[model samples]
Target: MIRSMTGYGKGEALSEQGRCTVEIRSVNHRYGEISVRMPRAFMALENEVKKALACTLKRGKIDAYVQWEEAGGCAALPAADLVLARGYAELLRSLSQELGLKEEPSLGLILAQKGVLGEAVAGQPDPDQCLAQLMSAVQGAVAAMDAMRRREGDALLCDLASRRGQVAQWVQRISERAPQVVDEYRQKLKIRLDQLLEGTEMDAARLAQEVALMADRCDVTEELVRLSSHFTQFDDALAADEPVGRKLDFLMQEMNREINTIGSKSSDAEVTSLVIRIKAEMEKMREQVQNVE
Candidate 1:
């Protein structure tokens, strides 16, 4: 079944290390693009995350957000700057001695000195464990998003099918009206000739030749046949189990081309009006195809 490019999904996984949550949002795009936002600790896994999304989602502008809530996670780990702490202790002891103070520098006092305690550079403690949890969460989120996209795709398919049928009906009407147009032209031409030749005989062979030429110029049989073939191809693509947005887009262009050709060749007002409506329907289908995958 086809899928739409717009959807949102969220998923999570838990492990002894932490709980990983992922949220994915996708929108229509001409090509595949996946962007991930996560803590600096998981930055190394950015490419892998993007690859996984692209592999499953195929085509779209996808944004993924990753959140790792450590059973006791910190934006950054608290660290004791041992070197700084030692220096502060030494300086305090020297000052106490110089002042002949009896009191020793309290551990807390030394520890609280400037830069004695600080935060460590953020980094993954266990990359393997993080990756496993992250991948699991990402997979779950992808599954959810896929389901939503499919549901939307079904709706899109119905609309496209209905429009296709409408266009086909209009094409049929145009086909039926084409012959009448030539016949009407022939009749009108004969009447004009008769009026001009008042009391004189008109050339029957010449009139038939003129009618034949007009019919040849206005024939839309081949265009209609090709358009019908495109419709079949469109249906086949829709039923296929793969990304067919580009294929459908191409087919719409082709169908539009044929319709334009027919419209240009047709002189009848009725056929022209039908062409206008078909073109309108084709435009709507093309817009809908842009959302399919």
Candidate 2:
């Protein structure tokens, strides 16, 4: 199915140990580009996350953020630098004796001193478990992103289809009116010739030859047929399941070329107006195709 290049998704996982969250944001881009932000410990998982995202997303500028939180983990642990605390106490007592001070140091005074206690926590995270939880979060985010892309893609497809139908309708109208243009020109030419040759003998063969040549010069059958074929190809490309942005763009170029050729060859005002409308629709489709993936 067609996918849009813009979307947003978020995923979260919670366990007994901690909670993990992942958020992804994407925007239209010519090529796929992924940037990730996570804890230093989780940096090794960036490659895996990027690979997973690339598998699902073909083209976009994607940004991902990951965060982890541990509950009831750091508060219960006691400080580890008891030796530093004892050393501070011995020094304080010596200072008191040397100054002949009478006040005694309390636990609050010792705890308030710098380097008396350590705040660092000790524990190694399980790589396998962390990886599993991260993958789960990534999967959820991927699903959400895909849904948004699909929804936008559906709207785009509908609009494109409608425009295609309109162009096809214009092509039909042009085809019907094109032949009449040449016929009208021929009749006008014949009338002018008759007026110029009034009361004079004229060669019927020469007049017929001149009209035939003029008709050939005004013929747009080949261009119309080729334009119809291009329209068909464009429709086929739209219905395709894979990335069709490039193909649709190429088809539009061909369609525009055919329309220009027809407009230049056909001198009728009505045909020219129809060609203009087709060009307008083609321009809109071209803009939309840029966001498709």
Show how many residue pairs clash in every candidate, following the order shown.
Answer: 0, 0
The list of candidate 2 runs beyond 4 A from truth reads: 72-128
- In candidate 2, clashing pairs total 0
TM-score of each: 0.84, 0.78
**What does candidate 1's lDDT look like per residue over 1-293, in tens digits?**
88999999999998877788999999999988888998887888898889888888999999999987766665666778898888888889899999999798999998778887786654354655578888999999999999999999999989998999899999999988989999899999999998999969888999999999999999999998999899999999989889999999999999999999999999899999999999998999999999997
| Candidate 2 per-residue C-alpha lDDT over 65-110 given as tens digits, one digit per residue, 9 for 90 to 100 | 9887674464434465789889888989999999999877788889
lDDT of each: 0.90, 0.85
- Misplaced by over 4 Å in model 1 are 73-124
True-vs-predicted CA distance for residue 221, candidate 1, Å: 1.2
lDDT, residue 4, model 1: 98
**Best by the TM-score measure:** 1
Error of 1 at 165 (Å): 0.9
